[model samples]
Target: MKERNHTTLTEFILLGFGSGLGLKEGPFVVFLVIYMTTTLGNTTMVFLISANSPLHISMYFFLMNLSFLDLCYSSTIAPKAMMSFLAGSKSISFHGCATQLFFFGLFASTEAFILAAMAYDRYTAICNPLLYPITMSKQVCIQLLVGSYVCGGVNSMVQTVFTFTLCFCGSNEIDHFFCDIPPLLSLSCTNTDINVLVLFTLSSLIIVSTSMVILVSYACIISAILRIRSAEGRHRAFSTCTSHMMSVILFYGTLTFIYAQPSSLSAPAQSKMVSVFYTLVIPMLNPLIYSLRNKDVREALGRTISSVFLK
Candidate 1:
């Protein structure tokens, strides 16, 4: 019996969804369209938020950050996967894989924090309407935004360093579309108990903490809305939160499913499907949901389009 060399791995072959599902061109077309839509949609969100003065408030400011995060997050995995699907080349250099892993974690974690901030903004706006302007002022919003990115960077650095430090003597074929911590940890030749523990701990802390913030904010918001005597006033107040709540549910639900459990408990195939939803579907849906459901965004979009076309 030959002992496996632990330090010889230089790259990893990502077994993309197409190969995993045994379909080539069909998945490629679907994913390509999804990628394009996500990119365009998120880009438009950023553009509209930045160019329109009416949307310069805290909610849209946080939304712009989210749009930027989604753009980077989807780019971290989607382009590589789409290229793999198109060119039938699934191999990624070790450094490239590590880079992807870092950015993916950074953007994802940052987005979670941003969502929490947005929830707090809503809470202030609805529950403490008189103080909303002071509570979510520009300086405070900037602080929160900066803090989210810093926390994300720290988290990414820790996870990337921990995951890549392990020796990969095992096969280099990752059973997913990207270089995720779980798939990479599964390939490690070293004992992965600490890595698994760290992954679980960090994931739980980020997801649970942010989710709690959102939950508490919404609880306060609901309470405040219930106090209103007029039904129309209550309905209008609740409507202001529906789009954000829907986004939070979709983003956090898929994320919790994918990251909240031990790697041993997750099936790679099922994980990939959930990953598809998280990475591709969510980003594409967020801007659409926010724009279609919110009257302000629609009016802004109409104004922006009219300005461009009329001139």
Candidate 2:
């Protein structure tokens, strides 16, 4: 293996699902619809949450932040991807690729932290009901959101800086749709041992730590729910958590599969497909999951719609 110097590569060619069996206008159009729905769905959720619902409670507050993160994460990749598909130019300038990586990392990490905070919120509400209001006060929720963003921003900076530090003076073809660390590292002619190590360390920190926190919180929640004598009470309590659990499973499962494995086994096409789940499909589903099941959100949406139409 050769060591890579600090030389610069001007542009990167994205080998997006290249020559796959069923990739063409039909699939591209389908992706366009998914991208559009993701944007609109998340945007609608954010707007609805902000207005009409006085539930300035911690759960909805964190949800709003999650919606914002989803919108951002989707935007960071999907539009450029659509362009690549339509224009037959899957080329991204090096700086543009770095920019995508930065925002993608930032929003993704933020969402993970926010989800963990939400699990903790659920635990507080279920296990320590009396102290829920005090524990998840407005100030504390705001602090959590701020801290989430701060952590994400710092991590993004570190990852992006290190990722771009090595030279890509030879191959510029990235095998995935978006600029992800795994595929980007593959294109580098450098010995990316340090970069790979940093990526793995960061992945472990973000995924493992957050996941443990969420799991512990949920464990407490499940324990508290099981203590409820009535079957209906238990059912209702479990229902409230179902959406969050599903979202966590999908996001983390794909993330761990793509990142935790040896790069030798990484499949660019498969990674892109799964990336669509977390980045595009999840955003659309999250708003629906939170809003469709909750009466408060439904009322809020109704109020918002009425306010808009009547005015």
Measured by lDDT, the strongest candidate is 1
Model 1 alpha-carbon drift over 4 Å, by segment: 1-7, 18-23, 263-265
lDDT of 1 by residue, 1-311 (tens): 13554447778988886445243677778888998999999999999999999999999999998989998999998878877776646789999999999999999999999999999999999998899899899999999999999988998999999998888886888888888998888888788899888888898899999999999999999999999999999999999899999999999998888877775336988888998999999999999999999898999999999999999
Candidate 1 contains a number of clashing pairs equal to 0
Q: Name the weakest run of 10 consecutive residues (lDDT summed) in model 2.
A: 19-28
- lDDT of all predictions, in order shown? 0.89, 0.82
In model 1, the clashing pairs are: none
lDDT of 2: 0.82
| Sequence-dependent TM-score of model 1 | 0.95
Model 2 Cα displacement at 164 (Å)? 0.5
Model 2 pairs whose backbones collide: none
